[model samples]
Target: MVSSLQKSMINLTQVLRLREHQKSFKELEKLGAIDVYYLEAIYQLKEPTIGTISKLLGQSTPNTNYHIKKLVNLKLIEKRIDDVDRRVTHLTVTSRYSELINSDEDFWTRTQERLESEIAATDLAIFQRVLRQTIEIISEESREDTISD
Candidate 1:
């Protein structure tokens, strides 16, 4: 059952990625796998500094900086110097990056519309509750791991 659940999650992720790639083929082409990965990390982390990102990724500062520089050059991300700590720089995704990546929101919206049309309302509510629980479980585990680290 767990394996099946994992497979479904993986399939969902692949489908989303495919949809995003199709929607932003040209912009996606300009980005390498590492570029996208780093962009996602930065986006999720909100305003992580270079050192924080390096630690989270278990990568060297220089290696992380290389990709960060590439992202900045591509205008996909912005680096802001910390106001309180001048030496620390925080990373943020740019509007261009949001525009390119948020195509997946359309995919989700469409999927929800279709699901609402096909599924019974009660069943959909139950599925939604289960999905929320799963996400919360994963988030709690991630927080635990981060705290431990």
Candidate 2:
């Protein structure tokens, strides 16, 4: 029999719900049309300036501004000028955008509650620990790859 962990990996790889439905997938698709790199830069850069974001995206300032304008129009992100350095403008995701990113909170909670009903808490804890360690290991490997590259 396949282990729970193996089943989980299979489920994640096998399911393509996000790609199958247009209406259901609209938000993600709209954001993706702007390029996944913009979202990644917004997440990883921590309120970086447009120039910084442009550099991170390997795009010209005009191109970065164009994407940023799209993000702003979509209400996915907001911009603020620095008080000390007016030339420095910072970009940040709106709280609503964060909520959109975390849209599966209710689904996960209901799934966990059902899971708890079917399994002992100790077993659940072990499963959670394993998942956490897996995430950490993947993160470490990614960092090592980045550093080596």
Candidate 3:
């Protein structure tokens, strides 16, 4: 038995979440069909080995290599051979990605400003906590599923 106000709040939250997700999907699409996992892997390790990136991305070595090659060709990232181990290569973001990073920062800053203007700090804090908890719960569920399967 939810009050009308409470139901409206729920709907508003749902709409906000959906809009954010759609915006993120669009940003990724604009980034040239790059895999989110690969982007995340690169973000986590600014300059990482192909093996490390593959493991972080949960992709095969060859698949990761292929995608990285494409990224290299696009001039979005560069590959450098390890000094100690010439056979091993590491991936690093290229100068071409400076614009991309700036765009991402602008997007986040604008979104944060809007949220700050519209939402109370306490409300935003609570929402952030809930989002973190939800992610943790989902991760645990996924781990359990993987173990069982």
Best by TM-score: 1
For model 3 the TM-score comes to 0.54
Compared with the true structure, model 2 gives a TM-score of 0.57
Q: Each candidate's TM vs. the true structure?
A: 0.79, 0.57, 0.54
lDDT, each prediction: 0.83, 0.73, 0.69
**lDDT per residue (tens digit) for residues 50-147 in model 3:** 87776655678899888888777767778899999998998887766655555557767998899888999999999789878865775566445534
Per-residue lDDT tens digits for candidate 1, residues 47-90, read: 88887777666778899999899999988899999999999999
**Candidate 1 vs candidate 2, TM-score winner:** 1
For model 2, state the Cα shift of residue 85 in Å: 0.6
Which digits, one per residue and each the tens of the lDDT, describe model 2 over residues 1-149? 99997898878745634433323546656755445568656765568778766765568888888889988888878999998998889988888678775676777698889989999999999989987998678656644554454
Off by over 4 Å in 1: 104-106, 136-149
TM-score of 1: 0.79
- Alpha-carbon RMSD, candidate 1: 2.7
Candidate 2: list runs displaced more than 4 Å.
1-24, 110-149
Cα displacement (angstroms), candidate 1, residue 90, comes to: 1.4
Tell me model 1's lDDT, rounded to 2 decimals.
0.83
The list of candidate 3 runs beyond 4 A from truth reads 1-34, 114-149
